[model samples]
Target chain A: MNVGIVIVSHSPLVAEGTAQMVRQMVGEEVRLAWCGGDPDGGLGTSVQAIIDAMESVWSDAGVAVLVDLGGAESNSEMAMEVIGEPRSARIRICNAPIVEGAVMAATEAAGGSSLATVVATAEELSPL
Target chain B: MSKTMTRLTSEDMKALIGAMQAAIAENAERLTALDQAIGDGDHGINMKRGFDAIAADADAICDKPTPQALSAAGMKLVMSVGGASGPLFGTLFMTLGKSLPEDFECGAFADAFAKAVDAVAARGKSSAGQKTMLDVLYPVSDALAAGKSVGEVAAVAAEAAEATVPMEAKRGRASFLGERSIGHMDPGSCSCSLLVNTIAAWISAKEHAA
Candidate 1:
């Protein structure tokens, strides 16, 4: 499976910006998703949007979810709960340094590395 | 809050750097565990990478005066480390280097350290409740701004860092955990507290020795 990447943020700008940076590190293979910055509301509709996106990408590989802000976070949790079982198994949530984590994870995934490897590399960006 | 100064020398910078290095190395597993739960589990790996780089240039950094050495170290981390924390943290130290005086005093460092926190926030676009490292960092900065001594800041920062546990993540990987994130402290916040405490301890020890 070719691992997928999802980035959720409070602002579309942040999500898109981080995606652009990670794309440079990982190239064309990774999938990107934004869960917030919806003009109509908060992360309300974005949750369904991400869930829909995840549904489409699961066949490729496990999906990695990165979120921004409180509402987006809560919404992501809802998505995870609803998207149960095998699909859920393929998904992981990364919160540390989003841009840094995404870039690291993408680079590792692009290199045909395992989720563990990418996740490990991505976590290095966290402050703790 | 009391009037004191942080008179750092080249030796002091080295010690602070050393403390950061040791903290990363020693806490690698714990850091990774925290990350793996909410993130990709490489907090230790990236920190090790950045700190290892810092250590490699230790002698060169130590050769310069305290502020210069600290600045160089920050620059090195930003340039070489390929993660968000690298640049964000690198900016922090660089800010400190810029704000700190040659004869670094505690009072000056406290003020400068607060500025350093601002730099990190600007770089990361993060704040205390956002559940990034700033969760710990903000409280510490506020303590310093309130004129708390290094030891005082250290205690408060450490407590604040620990308090991150049980708080739902407002940002980062743990954010996905939603409510689950509430029970766990952010690895970044955890490490940031270590950084703050290290600096505070260094300052306090220096004062005691003097």
Candidate 2:
């Protein structure tokens, strides 16, 4: 299976919109899931939602999480904590900007890049 | 008065949560104002939202043993608050919960608090003097480690929080503002101080009542 991508944002619209852009850039070769909003459907990221999204798009090839803002990063870390073990070992949180990072990482994943390479490709965008 | 309790009873936990909720509510606007100066102006609102979730679930949270109650409260904050502090503070409580025994002594609580502070620092890749929550958290944890009384710890935390006002931002969104971040209190530090002080006050009140 190709590598997977999970988009995390405080705003549901931002996550969905960024996922749409990644889909357009990478096509159907990569698996993708987007999670955003609080448990109450308000602005904020949810650890449960991030965990669920990661599971939905899990891949043996590896999964990369792109998060919006600091809160999303914090919640994503909590999700990873509970995820544990071999699965947690396979996932990585990218430090690049959410939208651009998702697109770049998805492209690399679609090409069957390893998790580290995909993350590196995305992080390379930081200087831009 | 000697505060000798090793473990906070469920009732004690409830009181602490109550005090925290009230403090956050009282300082919400001030937190927002602080954030507006150097970061996103939503620290107060975000903290209030997280604490409100804790309050809404207080009945269930307080029914559990201390560790479980703390963990539950942390989870609620993680799910409700959507800012950097959400994860930072969530991890703080969750780690503290995980580190504690079902019944713990003050020294045990100190160790747990230190672990929780470490977890938050690692999560944020932050350190003391970054003008983030760590500015407050670091001192409080240190005081706890030193075996200082809760009142003394709270006093140290408040001083550290206030000291953040003149420090340069080295992490988080505020760091983007560079030197401009100075002169503004870090919102996370303010909230952290408020929580620590509330806990101190609650414990003192309980001691007085006895």
Give all candidate RMSDs, comma-separated: 14.9, 2.0
Query: Using TM-score as the measure, which candidate wins?
Result: 2
Rate residue B188 of model 1 by lDDT: 84
Q: Candidates' DockQ values? A: 0.03, 0.69
lDDT of 1 by residue, B126-160 (tens): 67787788888778777777777667888987898
**For each candidate, what TM-score against the reference?**
0.60, 0.93
Lowest summed lDDT window (length 10), candidate 1 chain A: A36-45
Q: Which candidate is the best by lDDT?
A: 2
Q: Evaluate model 1 with DockQ and give the value.
A: 0.03
Clashes of 2: 4
Candidate 2 Cα outliers beyond 4 Å, as residue runs: A39-43, B1-3
lDDT of 2: 0.87
- The runs of at least 3 residues in candidate 1 whose Cα sits more than 4 Å from the true structure, single-residue gaps closed, are A1-128, B1-6
